[model samples]
Target: MEFGEKIKELRTTNQMTQEKFALRLNVTRQAVSNWENNRNLPDLEMLILISTIFHISLDELILGGSTVNNMTEKLIKDGSETRRAKFNMITTLIGALFLFLGAAFFFIKAHSVEYIDSSGILHENFYLLPTGFFFIFIGIIIFLTTGITFVNSYIKSRR
Candidate 1:
């Protein structure tokens, strides 16, 4: 069942009016109405609060239905484009994070020389190595390549 359905079910089971629930949540009665009708979703904090007030775990409240499982199965079976879009988005985010971390490491190494010997002459800093820059470059390349792949896949799947 969708979250709204669960909310309505729980509310009815407890015999609580929308007005009462709304008051408890510090929201308007219309907001409760909206939630029950699936017109909108509650924010994470409110969702947690609702689960707590109803004495149910978030997992139980959100995912305790065979209907939801069947829906997921159907979506997976269908291989819908929407799923591809979601995958592309996830891959893009992962690639971006890797690239950012790699770039950061590269910057840290490139700037390490600033903290070198007071002699202001040629010296070696064991902490800073040429390999660091190489890794950073590799990271940026991976990020760009992955980003391109994600965009391409997203576009192709849309078609």
Candidate 2:
């Protein structure tokens, strides 16, 4: 039997569905489906884990038909992509929050704003514009830097 068929048979014989099996494998159901369909192969580490879980040898898991070496690169790429997406989402949320607060400050002013003078004297002044612009600049910088890093990592991973 083919590798895909073997996986399917093992899964069925164990009475484990794709989702349950994926939970054991720490991967998504789609990934397991792809593996069983022969559309993809797990990495060496995963293959070892699967063999251990099934109480089978690596030879049987791969049918001794050249394991590990032929596994697709997509699994590694998938993990990287998931992490990148999470990082991008967090940064985007924080950046947007900063920008929103900055813009809000431009329209909302404190009734009595106090600040310390250069000479250390206390003074009452509306420093909202400067503070608002400072936040805006920070937000812009965050966007630029994160954007650049995201692009760079994506490019590197493609290779």
Residue-wise C-alpha lDDT for candidate 1, range 1-159, written one tens digit per residue: 766778888998999999999989999999989877877767668868998999998667756575563324333545666675677677667656665665666677666654446776656454444555555566577667767877787688589
Best by TM-score: 2
Q: What is the Å distance of residue 10 in model 1 from its true position?
A: 1.6
User: What are the per-residue Cα lDDT tens digits for candidate 2 across 44-131?
Assistant: 7988998998899977676535444233334456667889899899998888888988888886755456789799988754678798
Q: Give the poorly placed runs of model 2, Cα more than 4 Å off.
A: 1-38, 41-76, 110-125
- Against the reference, the lDDT scores of all candidates come to 0.71, 0.80
Residue 73's lDDT in candidate 2: 37
Backbone clashes in each candidate structure, one number apiece? 0, 0
Name the runs in model 1 displaced over 4 angstroms: 69-140, 149-159
